[model samples]
Target chain A: MSCRIGMDVGGTNVVTGLFDSEGRLLRRSKVRTIKLSSCELIQQLAGQCKEILAAEGVRESELEAVGIGLPGFIQSESGVVSSANLPFNDVPVATRLQQLLGVPVAVENDVKMVVYGEYLHGAGKGYSHVLGLTIGTGMASAWVSDGRLHEGAGGLAGEIGHISFPDISYMCGCGMKGCLETVASTAGIARQARDGLKAGWVGLLAERFPPEIRDELTSHDVWQAYLDGDAFAGQVFQRTANWLSRVLVPSIALLSPDVIIVGGGVAAAGDIFFDSLRSYVSASLHPLYRERLRIVPPSLGDDGGLYGSAEFALKSRKIGLRI
Target chain B: MSCRIGMDVGGTNVVTGLFDSEGRLLRRSKVRTIKLSSCELIQQLAGQCKEILAAEGVRESELEAVGIGLPGFIQSESGVVSSANLPFNDVPVATRLQQLLGVPVAVENDVKMVVYGEYLHGAGKGYSHVLGLTIGTGMASAWVSDGRLHEGAGGLAGEIGHISFPDISYMCGCGMKGCLETVASTAGIARQARDGLKAGWVGLLAERFPPEIRDELTSHDVWQAYLDGDAFAGQVFQRTANWLSRVLVPSIALLSPDVIIVGGGVAAAGDIFFDSLRSYVSASLHPLYRERLRIVPPSLGDDGGLYGSAEFALKSRKIGLRI
Candidate 1:
């Protein structure tokens, strides 16, 4: 059994799992992504790995390889840090992990790995063309063409969220004005709702809201409020759906993928986001393609990135081991 | 020499050229595409092929393969008839062409051939990621990833013009509403300009026009007028430039290809198009990618489609002879 470890490195939590050849997860563990300096973060991750091994009752020699999936631009070849999400700059992640764990390591942008999983075993399975989109505080996408993941030149192929979109006027973190993220992301929705509430505008905002809660409203909370029948929340979701569909419909027409796997925390809004998006996308599509574009929820859900990481590690490893 | 013949089938003209192993265009010939039934067109094309062979003093056995490039979708494996521009309705183009021409024939979509040319011998050479865009009567894009032109699951990738966008006020030829072509194509520009002139809007158009040509205008004439520094022409070019850049900036940021080559008649706007598009794209991009994207002209020029057709045919042969 050539078992490997896969980890999704998030700001607050880190989830690691040992997976086998057939995509079955053998063992899993979770830990905090402890706040620390550059050297200390790596040390903490190393400790977590040991903990996972101990908890799984597996020998160190049993582990074949390790794959870590993180957010941002990943230098796949050298495994250096190119994205802004991680603390370390230009850190040789795979090399350091290989030395620490005594096994080969593969690192990739988290969502990119998720896209791989989606195409292989999730909603995108059996399709040679797919666009896996993650809609959270930010937006990002990955491309699968002809049953192969497309890692574009310079590894920046699926950075759709950072690009400027039409009719948007705000600046994005990447310094671009009116990026897709500014209009369609969860953050965009929450912010719009928050502003509307702050202005005392007539909407379905709960008047008995906590003061602290009013200061920091997330898309999650907004969705909850909408389900509670908040008109503003519904309007915000509709706007987000419409705007996102503007980009997505065109993308689908251009790529004509077999499926679109929508992921991320925002997708949890479910029908609120999907209904409007589907309708708008259909209404906007060229007549020749309106009936053919298919959009669906990601089957792998939150663990998509972790599964993809495991798949990548398994494919790249040459040794046999366990968790 | 085992030379191959590459044919680019257009609505009006059918161009056939012989290509050697070294990428040299050995001989060339052309004939009108007989606007007739599917069988008659095939007969006429076969006759044209025979004429070209006899005129070039080449023997039948010397030819290795025949490749045809058309302006619509191609199921290269089955040689399905998918072209909207041609009169043929669901005909077996590759098999019939092979039988008529008495050689191995491979048929491919036109843009596929264009991207192939860029990959093998044009601006896209040595790069693993490339996008070829044409802004003529309609917009079209081709994507080449990792040395291969990516065809989506349904052989429908890279159809950018058909992507639904923000154009809610106009109708597209595809019968879809809000498609990108409604605003970003040469036809779009001409339509806007012609409308402007007919409405008797005050500008340099009236000053430069001879009353006879004021209202009935074309995009090409607008370019020539812009070159002459007509006031209305200046505004026309500026508006068109903005539209072109608006589409390009976000596209480049999202896809992040190694190179984006602009082609088609509207692309010949040269600096009139390139200069503004550069500034606009830079302004539209995230700071991280401001310096990453490169915009260039098509090196293969009008011949790019021809060369791309040759490469696509040769490559398709490796996948399977098809016929």
Candidate 2:
């Protein structure tokens, strides 16, 4: 009879879902995320939680817990520390939501949530050590060891985006030069394409978008061109895969995780991108480690984060009782 | 007197020490390690263990366990799987040692042992997460999270040496091109010195070791020349630090460990090398992560792996009991 509600608050959208103890989705809701004040965002999320619970014929008293996943720097005890994309800064999200719903609440980083969800129910299921990489507006990753998220000393583990690449000249939003995200994320891909076109590197993009509109070129366009057999577009994707292999090789060598589950907007590019990436990563890895390492797409997709939030809430509730 | 014997089996030497529960070193012994068959190596290690225990006036009945730290891929339950530097391949190290000593035996990768030793009693003491990097003849690393070694699925985690560096063309011993170790380890530094001198690049090394003996130049020679104000030597060391920083920046971003402790032969170059490395890594790290991250030297020196082996044996005994 126990049910829980999970929410994924992203830069573009906020998704909430109600699930039974067995992980069955009972009800769900979505809303466009706006640049609102901390209090406003909290109120909006709380309202949606109530709506989902009511739609599922569940009451606040009967709810087990509410878990939320948000993008940004987070301290589990204090909530959102700071988010580059979200307006929440130093907000106590879990406490605020708990007060509103009269139930236990847990707040975790969005990527970590997705990793935990995958570890428990998605691609990472059955793995002792799971590594999750999400490449979108930025490149980020999370680590799960023995079914527990391996949050480093500063609660800042898995900030893979800030890894420096001296050969790269692009500056990252994190105020660093040549960060992995500056060359590997969706934003990075588009930037690379734009720079290539501006430098007289002829390609399908150049023909499709004139010089004036080239700046508006997106990763989607680059993918389409690559699929259409444009040599330049193929180079861009190949370079991306190589850059990713550079980072992943070390990660695989260091962590030796059972499985590496890749997610996010960019990962939706599917087999075309992953087939090349898997081969590159395998070929580049140490022979001893190459045998067991598997890199695959996330099966839960966007809902992975929501499911992770629910899993987080359930696990946190169990830990709270033991305490 | 629950005494334990800890043995560190490196490519060049074997060091064995006897310690009490307080982790106090009571007796120690050392022997040169040659390229011997797995059986010969095991016999040598057992002989040294007996020598140390007898010298400490400890009887077999008084011994709690035996722990060994060796260079290779280790499956703790089964012992050495494969060692790139050592002669152990699919060798049952723990069982052999246990049979020889008639006590519980736990075997772990040498780097992992050093990390555990540092985490429990050395520079990494009081930290929740610790990362250890050893740059000797080759580069390697180990990670300790929440007081446990974060061994990846295949017990091949912490193999940072194999991370590929596309820009550099140096071939690594691991049969990979452009690995971090190809440009950052002691051998790498010596190679760089040799290559620089061969190209008619002037340095203190050229003056000290004539053209004929230039090939005999070692990393120590490079360090000495750098101290003597040789520009080529300085560049080699600078480039080495830069490569270390490149690998470290990503590791720091991903793990966010409380401390990063650098050890091994190359690290013996001392403050002249570490000072520059600390500054470069600090500057390259994200602002949020840079504040709390610490990069420091290993305090246990050569004794770290031995202490780590002792710690491992003790902990394994406790776990075995629970099971």
Candidate 3:
């Protein structure tokens, strides 16, 4: 049985997994994503592939293909694009990997890969039309209809985070003011918490976080405070939910997907985030749609991206071999 | 050469067209859509089909199939569903039409048909991922990706009009408060103008439309006053554009279509409506997407729905014959 290597490349770490044709994860490895040149990063990734193969006692010839998922605007056809956080721009990722590994390689946006992974093997398994939202440091979404990803005209589809929230005035990293990301993301939550504290808004946060640590309060801290029943934290969380619902409601209206799978750190807050969100979404949805729509958390959790990359590689290899 | 019949059934009219295999309209006919029973509406549509066929001198034997586009939540496979504006609920449109016309019948949502028409023969011809927005009495949108319509799980997709706008408090016809339709549709615009007039907000509307006519002022009157350089009318139009941009900017970020095709009576206001809308949408978009996206008017105008219905019939017929 042929195996493939799937890699999820992020700003902080590179996660690689080995899986067989049926998408069973045989082995896995990870390495820190150091600030290196594009060529160096590619070399490190190839080295990790070799290390995994050696650990598994498999030869390069026995592998079918490799797939990589990373952050960026991906030109899927050429497997090249640029991202602000990455070390390189216009990097031909698939070509470079194929040259080094002597196998076909597939590359796609990381979030899209995660969505594909969920669609193939996780919560989205049985749904033909799936919408996946990942809310972490930033927000991103991907759409899969009829079992294929809708990458859009420029492969920039599903950038839900950058949607302008005309009511807000926060400047976003994407150079736009009042983007949904500024108000709905993990970073956004943390920023709001910090600003509220600075403004002398009294809440349970004062008791939960002392003076020294208060300055470094993150979204996790805010979430913990909310869990501890802090009114301010609860309000912040509610605002995020409101912003998310504003975008999600319209999205549901526009896409009408069978399932909406939400993942990432914020979703890990569990019922604290989802319960109210589900109610808000359901209450706001048209009667015709509210009863049938499913909003749930991703089952695969963090590994979804890796599994998706592997599945994509296997699918692409099969097609390549068929051709 | 085989011909086909296509029908666009709306709340006010039933338009029928005869088209050859190439999607060219050979002949057309229309009849007023009185508030008939479902059976009567079906009979009227069937009668119009026969009238068009006779006018074109095309025999039923030479026709491939018939396609109908109407407003409703469609179960495309069964071609049965309900809509708020339609006189009947759970109407078996295709089954009834097939029985009456003695031919294969395919039915779909009217907006989806218009998008398909635009995709096939209008301004959306060259784009693989197309988004069509029709702003008339209400707002609706449809998406075409990879040459196929993305009909969501329940065919309730593209109902952007019902998306809640939390910032607004206006009640919508859909039994929801602050839906986008309350602020962005033709009715929404008219309501805002009427409300502003009632609130005694002084504007050129008072002069353009005296007290008697003020009570009957429509969206067209608002548009006319805006064109005639009324500040309040312009602000009203700008507010509508703002609300539209709020929804559309996010849609652009999420869908990233090649072009956004705007149609319907509101769009017929020409550059008076589009120029400002285009500027607002552009100014609000992330730089990554703003440069590549095009928002333009539909080339086929009102006939887009008819052509789309006809084209859908031809395509469905070919597939049916293949099966």
Q: Which candidate number would show the highest DockQ if scored against the true structure?
A: 3
B128-232, model 1: which lDDT tens digit per residue? Answer: 778788777667777787777766656766677766555436777777666667666777777777767777866555555545875566787878878877667
lDDT of 3 by residue, A76-143 (tens): 77788687778869988888888998888898889999999999899999998999998887799999
CAPRI-style quality class for the chain A–B interface of candidate 2:
medium
Which model is ahead, 2 or 3, in terms of DockQ? 3
Candidate 3 docks at the CAPRI level of medium
Each candidate's interface RMSD:
2.2, 1.5, 1.3
| lDDT tens digits, residue span A173-262, model 1 | 776577878767877877777777777756446563545677677777788888988887887888888767755765765567778888
Ranking by TM-score: 3, 2, 1
Give the poorly placed runs of model 2, Cα more than 4 Å off.
Answer: A201-203, A321-323, B33-37, B84-87, B321-323
What fraction of the real A-B contacts shows up in model 2? 0.80
Judged by TM-score relative to the true structure, which candidate is superior, 1 or 2?
A: 2
Candidate 3 yields a Cα-based lDDT of: 0.83
Residues B1-323, candidate 3, lDDT per residue (tens digit)? 78888788889888888898777888878889877888888888888888888888878788778888888778877888687877768877888888888788889889889989999899999788899988877788999888788778866789888877657899887788888888787888888998898888676787766667777888889888888888888888777776777668778878899999988767777776787788888887788788897889999867898889887877776677211
User: What's the residue-level lDDT of B169 in candidate 3?
Assistant: 94
TM-score of every model versus the real structure: 0.93, 0.95, 0.95
| Cα lDDT listed for each candidate | 0.74, 0.83, 0.83
Clashes of each: 7, 0, 0
- Cα lDDT tens digits, model 2, B227-314, are 8889888788777877888668778877888999998877888776787788788877778787996888899888898899997898
